[model samples]
Target: MPVDQETTARDGDTPDDLGSVQYAQTAVVPMDPAHLERHRVVAHQKAHPASWAFDVLRTQVLQKMDESGWRTLAVTSPSVESGKTVVAINLAISIAQQTNRTALLVDFDLRRPSVARSLGLNRPKSLNDFLDGHASLAEALVNPGIERFVVLPTNRPVNSASELLSSAKVGKLIKDLRERYSDRIVIFDLPPVLAADDVMSVLPRIDCVLMVVGSGVSTQTEVEEAMNRLSKANMLGVILNKDESPTQNAYY
Candidate 1:
């Protein structure tokens, strides 16, 4: 099934007459360049046990995800405040640095949209507007500070985010995005699996899942039980959140 042409383009929306749509943010903001440099430093710090392990970990993650034909991935954790949002945003920034590849970081944790706040973006258009036919995807996307990366921040808190995610409309939207941006990657910062069934709903729609586990915070039992709750087996993996002591953990 194809998304209707009428649906893709909004009614009464005419193409901007030769640069009329030009905006200062998209035109002047060097979001991509700055974001990559920041994330490169951050990844270095996270990946290595030394001062710059994050960079190495970032590279490893990119390589692994690339090798697996992964484009749409859900970043989740066992519970909230586990640094899942932090990892998702930084990982998306790191991945967007790849040559000729763009990354779309979507905030699907509709119940608590911390990605936008963490990034300092104020009340941006959200996944709700896009899913509810209130805004076009492009209109909802913000360039932020990265050229190859765009973010769809969830500005409004939804009452039933899980239901919306599981709807047929969401499946079709994600499918269209995957096909449209074959060269780009879509990273969703999903709600915690144990906290809600939102991630479970979108499990079948995404390419893979990256479980973010906070060091000293997430227990083995929680990780295992969360994995058992997911629908697909191979789609899941783990990214450990290191502590000041640099302790590491793993997930399925």
Candidate 2:
């Protein structure tokens, strides 16, 4: 797979006649095979039945986003353990795998960032460092060994996560990522809507939102409250995850 580098002008740097800027670039890092298998990151494992579900999800999600001219998607749930992160990761991988689109998965759940762990990536420099002014956006991106797929993982929890998400830096970051590439789909694995205010703080910056509800986990009241909170945001749809119904698969 070819890596596309987007450059920017530095201090005192001049742009070319074509208006192209010169800057440092980042490359993809290979992921561990064993680690991926251990964590059930099966989207890349095309032979797995679970991978098909994500492919279906990817088709629907991309269609909606394209119809609305939306590029950034935030995946959240009513509460913790609702498998939002899993859905986010798998959806991204499936999109990248099935289409020419580039899928960028961002771990924006600063309170309990798990995208890296779930993808079996080590403590690579991530969004925590980027937001703290210790790393650049390119430095924070990891390829996770998937073609046309990248990830901005958060290695640890941050204090005042809601405030951080609401900060100007975060807003700029979101804008930059969204506008960086027209063909790229940036998916944010945000914290549960009811677990913290972080989701609400960042929801406005995202193009659309997707709620993941685990079967038998989220209560009716909890779902209603989540819907109320997201009423103002452009909600793409709700995903019913971990379904055990004999008639349907695990995910819907």
Write down the RMSD of all candidates, one decimal each. Answer: 7.1, 4.0
Q: Estimate the TM-score of every prediction.
A: 0.76, 0.88
Error of 2 at 214 (Å): 0.8
How well does candidate 2 match the true structure in TM-score terms? 0.88
Candidate closest to the true structure, highest lDDT: 2
lDDT for each of the candidates? Answer: 0.66, 0.80
Q: Which lDDT tens digits does candidate 1 get at residues 26-98?
A: 3112233344333322432234443233334456655667897777888888887677887777667666664
User: Any idea what lDDT model 2 has?
Assistant: 0.80
**lDDT of candidate 2 over 1-252, digit per residue (tens):** 225544454345334211222312545667777876666567888887677877878888889999999999999999988778878988898888898888889999998999988877775588898788787666777776677888889998997999999998888778867775688899999999999789999999999999999878999999999999999999988888765321122433
